[model samples]
Target: MALAQRRPPGLKAVVNVAGGLISAIAWRRAWMRSSRPSRHWPWKDTLPQLWVYAGNDDLFPPSLVDGMRAAALDRGGDVRLIALPDVSPRGHAILQNGRARFVWLREMDTSLRA
Candidate 1:
Protein backbone atom coordinates (compact mmCIF):
# COMPACT_ATOMS: atom_id res chain seq x y z
CA MET A 1 0.00 0.00 0.00
CA ALA A 2 2.66 2.45 1.02
CA LEU A 3 4.84 1.41 -1.84
CA ALA A 4 2.03 1.80 -4.36
CA GLN A 5 1.20 5.18 -2.95
CA ARG A 6 4.81 6.25 -3.21
CA ARG A 7 5.28 4.77 -6.66
CA PRO A 8 1.92 5.09 -8.31
CA PRO A 9 2.90 4.35 -11.91
CA GLY A 10 1.96 1.18 -13.74
CA LEU A 11 1.55 -1.03 -10.67
CA LYS A 12 -0.56 -4.14 -10.94
CA ALA A 13 -1.87 -4.27 -7.35
CA VAL A 14 -0.98 -3.74 -3.72
CA VAL A 15 -1.32 -5.89 -0.60
CA ASN A 16 -0.65 -3.89 2.52
CA VAL A 17 -0.12 -6.34 5.36
CA ALA A 18 -0.15 -4.09 8.40
CA GLY A 19 1.99 -1.54 6.64
CA GLY A 20 1.78 2.24 6.21
CA LEU A 21 3.74 5.44 6.54
CA ILE A 22 1.98 6.95 9.56
CA SER A 23 2.69 3.79 11.54
CA ALA A 24 6.35 4.64 11.23
CA ILE A 25 5.99 7.03 14.12
CA ALA A 26 4.67 5.69 17.45
CA TRP A 27 5.63 8.16 20.10
CA ARG A 28 2.15 9.59 20.31
CA ARG A 29 -1.33 8.11 20.25
CA ALA A 30 -3.67 10.47 18.42
CA TRP A 31 -6.74 9.98 16.27
CA MET A 32 -5.65 10.27 12.66
CA ARG A 33 -8.92 11.55 11.25
CA SER A 34 -7.68 15.14 11.22
CA SER A 35 -4.01 14.32 11.24
CA ARG A 36 -1.89 15.03 8.19
CA PRO A 37 -1.69 11.35 7.45
CA SER A 38 -5.43 11.12 7.20
CA ARG A 39 -5.34 13.58 4.30
CA HIS A 40 -2.18 12.15 2.76
CA TRP A 41 -3.52 9.23 0.80
CA PRO A 42 -1.99 9.70 -2.65
CA TRP A 43 -3.66 6.70 -4.26
CA LYS A 44 -6.95 8.29 -5.22
CA ASP A 45 -5.88 8.31 -8.84
CA THR A 46 -4.46 4.79 -8.68
CA LEU A 47 -5.99 1.38 -8.26
CA PRO A 48 -7.77 0.06 -5.23
CA GLN A 49 -5.65 -1.11 -2.28
CA LEU A 50 -6.06 -4.02 0.10
CA TRP A 51 -4.97 -3.48 3.69
CA VAL A 52 -4.84 -6.52 5.96
CA TYR A 53 -4.14 -5.96 9.62
CA ALA A 54 -4.66 -8.04 12.71
CA GLY A 55 -7.06 -6.70 15.27
CA ASN A 56 -4.64 -7.15 18.13
CA ASP A 57 -1.78 -5.59 16.24
CA ASP A 58 -0.06 -3.33 18.70
CA LEU A 59 2.11 -1.84 16.01
CA PHE A 60 -0.91 -0.57 14.07
CA PRO A 61 -3.96 -0.75 16.29
CA PRO A 62 -7.53 -0.54 14.98
CA SER A 63 -7.93 2.88 16.46
CA LEU A 64 -5.19 4.22 14.25
CA VAL A 65 -5.97 2.21 11.15
CA ASP A 66 -9.62 3.16 11.30
CA GLY A 67 -8.73 6.81 11.14
CA MET A 68 -6.41 6.15 8.25
CA ARG A 69 -9.20 4.32 6.47
CA ALA A 70 -11.59 7.16 6.98
CA ALA A 71 -9.04 9.61 5.70
CA ALA A 72 -8.27 7.59 2.61
CA LEU A 73 -11.93 7.16 1.85
CA ASP A 74 -12.51 10.84 2.29
CA ARG A 75 -9.71 11.48 -0.15
CA GLY A 76 -11.32 9.11 -2.67
CA GLY A 77 -8.65 6.47 -2.40
CA ASP A 78 -9.91 2.98 -3.14
CA VAL A 79 -8.78 1.14 -0.04
CA ARG A 80 -10.36 -1.84 1.66
CA LEU A 81 -9.12 -2.67 5.11
CA ILE A 82 -9.72 -6.13 6.55
CA ALA A 83 -9.38 -5.93 10.28
CA LEU A 84 -8.95 -9.58 11.07
CA PRO A 85 -9.50 -11.13 14.47
CA ASP A 86 -6.54 -11.61 16.72
CA VAL A 87 -4.51 -14.26 14.97
CA SER A 88 -1.59 -14.61 17.39
CA PRO A 89 -0.53 -13.60 20.86
CA ARG A 90 2.26 -11.69 19.16
CA GLY A 91 -0.28 -8.99 18.21
CA HIS A 92 1.60 -7.92 15.06
CA ALA A 93 1.74 -11.14 13.07
CA ILE A 94 -0.74 -11.13 10.18
CA LEU A 95 -0.12 -14.59 8.65
CA GLN A 96 1.70 -16.17 11.56
CA ASN A 97 -1.37 -18.28 12.22
CA GLY A 98 -2.78 -20.65 9.64
CA ARG A 99 -6.38 -19.88 10.49
CA ALA A 100 -6.30 -16.34 9.04
CA ARG A 101 -5.24 -17.33 5.55
CA PHE A 102 -8.74 -17.96 4.27
CA VAL A 103 -10.09 -14.58 5.28
CA TRP A 104 -7.10 -12.52 4.23
CA LEU A 105 -6.69 -14.46 1.02
CA ARG A 106 -10.31 -13.94 0.15
CA GLU A 107 -10.06 -10.22 0.64
CA MET A 108 -6.79 -10.12 -1.22
CA ASP A 109 -8.28 -11.92 -4.18
CA THR A 110 -11.23 -9.59 -4.31
CA SER A 111 -9.13 -6.46 -4.02
CA LEU A 112 -6.60 -7.75 -6.52
CA ARG A 113 -9.31 -8.62 -8.96
CA ALA A 114 -10.59 -5.09 -8.79
Candidate 2:
Protein backbone atom coordinates (compact mmCIF):
# COMPACT_ATOMS: atom_id res chain seq x y z
CA MET A 1 0.00 0.00 0.00
CA ALA A 2 2.87 2.34 0.75
CA LEU A 3 4.38 1.65 -2.62
CA ALA A 4 1.10 2.15 -4.43
CA GLN A 5 0.59 5.48 -2.74
CA ARG A 6 4.05 6.61 -3.81
CA ARG A 7 3.40 5.95 -7.48
CA PRO A 8 1.59 8.17 -9.93
CA PRO A 9 -2.23 8.07 -9.91
CA GLY A 10 -2.54 5.25 -12.41
CA LEU A 11 0.74 3.46 -11.79
CA LYS A 12 1.28 0.64 -9.31
CA ALA A 13 4.31 -1.61 -9.04
CA VAL A 14 5.67 -3.95 -6.37
CA VAL A 15 8.80 -5.98 -5.75
CA ASN A 16 8.45 -9.11 -3.66
CA VAL A 17 11.71 -10.78 -2.68
CA ALA A 18 12.12 -14.16 -0.98
CA GLY A 19 8.61 -14.13 0.43
CA GLY A 20 7.04 -17.05 2.26
CA LEU A 21 3.76 -18.96 1.85
CA ILE A 22 1.85 -16.22 3.63
CA SER A 23 2.87 -13.75 0.98
CA ALA A 24 1.80 -16.17 -1.73
CA ILE A 25 -1.62 -16.53 -0.13
CA ALA A 26 -2.15 -12.78 -0.09
CA TRP A 27 -1.28 -12.53 -3.77
CA ARG A 28 -3.58 -15.39 -4.60
CA ARG A 29 -6.42 -13.59 -2.83
CA ALA A 30 -5.65 -10.45 -4.78
CA TRP A 31 -5.73 -12.35 -8.07
CA MET A 32 -8.95 -14.07 -7.10
CA ARG A 33 -10.53 -10.72 -6.37
CA SER A 34 -9.25 -9.34 -9.67
CA SER A 35 -10.99 -12.22 -11.52
CA ARG A 36 -14.34 -11.60 -9.88
CA PRO A 37 -16.00 -8.42 -11.07
CA SER A 38 -18.75 -8.83 -8.52
CA ARG A 39 -16.19 -8.58 -5.73
CA HIS A 40 -15.21 -5.24 -4.30
CA TRP A 41 -11.69 -4.31 -5.35
CA PRO A 42 -10.40 -1.88 -2.76
CA TRP A 43 -7.77 -0.51 -5.06
CA LYS A 44 -8.43 2.01 -7.80
CA ASP A 45 -5.53 0.53 -9.76
CA THR A 46 -4.05 -2.87 -10.42
CA LEU A 47 -0.43 -3.21 -9.46
CA PRO A 48 2.25 -4.74 -11.65
CA GLN A 49 4.57 -6.75 -9.43
CA LEU A 50 7.89 -8.56 -9.56
CA TRP A 51 8.73 -11.63 -7.52
CA VAL A 52 12.34 -12.62 -6.84
CA TYR A 53 13.16 -15.89 -5.20
CA ALA A 54 16.06 -18.22 -4.62
CA GLY A 55 15.99 -21.23 -6.93
CA ASN A 56 16.15 -23.71 -4.05
CA ASP A 57 14.02 -21.90 -1.49
CA ASP A 58 12.25 -24.51 0.57
CA LEU A 59 9.69 -22.23 2.18
CA PHE A 60 8.48 -20.66 -1.06
CA PRO A 61 9.66 -22.83 -3.92
CA PRO A 62 10.33 -21.45 -7.35
CA SER A 63 7.53 -23.58 -8.74
CA LEU A 64 5.07 -21.98 -6.31
CA VAL A 65 6.22 -18.50 -7.22
CA ASP A 66 5.95 -19.38 -10.91
CA GLY A 67 2.41 -20.58 -10.37
CA MET A 68 1.47 -17.33 -8.63
CA ARG A 69 3.06 -15.33 -11.41
CA ALA A 70 1.05 -17.21 -14.02
CA ALA A 71 -2.19 -16.71 -12.11
CA ALA A 72 -1.56 -13.01 -11.60
CA LEU A 73 -0.80 -12.55 -15.28
CA ASP A 74 -3.89 -14.49 -16.25
CA ARG A 75 -5.98 -12.11 -14.16
CA GLY A 76 -4.48 -9.22 -16.17
CA GLY A 77 -2.24 -8.23 -13.28
CA ASP A 78 1.30 -7.50 -14.37
CA VAL A 79 3.78 -9.83 -12.69
CA ARG A 80 7.30 -11.16 -13.20
CA LEU A 81 9.58 -13.63 -11.45
CA ILE A 82 13.33 -14.01 -11.13
CA ALA A 83 14.84 -17.09 -9.54
CA LEU A 84 18.44 -16.93 -8.45
CA PRO A 85 20.53 -20.08 -8.82
CA ASP A 86 21.38 -21.55 -5.40
CA VAL A 87 20.35 -24.38 -3.11
CA SER A 88 20.67 -23.12 0.45
CA PRO A 89 18.91 -23.15 3.79
CA ARG A 90 18.32 -19.45 3.23
CA GLY A 91 14.93 -20.19 1.78
CA HIS A 92 13.15 -17.05 3.04
CA ALA A 93 16.23 -14.91 3.43
CA ILE A 94 16.36 -12.09 0.93
CA LEU A 95 19.20 -10.33 2.73
CA GLN A 96 21.32 -13.42 3.21
CA ASN A 97 24.40 -11.62 1.98
CA GLY A 98 25.61 -8.40 0.45
CA ARG A 99 24.96 -9.46 -3.12
CA ALA A 100 21.50 -10.83 -2.36
CA ARG A 101 20.70 -7.65 -0.48
CA PHE A 102 21.88 -5.63 -3.44
CA VAL A 103 19.55 -7.51 -5.74
CA TRP A 104 16.61 -6.52 -3.54
CA LEU A 105 17.67 -2.90 -3.62
CA ARG A 106 18.09 -2.96 -7.37
CA GLU A 107 14.70 -4.50 -7.94
CA MET A 108 13.02 -1.98 -5.63
CA ASP A 109 14.76 0.89 -7.39
CA THR A 110 13.80 -0.43 -10.78
CA SER A 111 10.20 -0.91 -9.74
CA LEU A 112 9.89 2.57 -8.25
CA ARG A 113 11.42 4.14 -11.35
CA ALA A 114 9.08 2.38 -13.73
Give the winner by TM-score.
Answer: 1
Weakest lDDT window of 10 consecutive positions for candidate 1? 25-34
Q: Where does candidate 2 clash, by residue pair?
A: none
Q: What's model 1's TM-score?
A: 0.77
After TM-score superposition, the amount by which residue 68's alpha carbon in candidate 1 deviates from its true location, in angstroms, is: 0.7
Candidate 1: tens digits of C-alpha lDDT, residues 1-114: 557767656787678887877544441244333356544544463457788888898888887778767767777767778888887765577777777878889888877776
**For residues 27-97, what per-residue lDDT tens digits would candidate 2 score against the true structure?**
54564567553232223435767778887777676766666656555556666676776634475665665
TM-score of 2: 0.63
TM-score of each: 0.77, 0.63
> In model 1, which regions exceed 4 Å deviation?
22-37, 40-45
Model 1, position 105, has a per-residue lDDT of: 91
Counting only residues 3 or more apart in sequence or on different chains, how many pairs clash (N, Cα, C under 3 Å) in candidate 2? 0
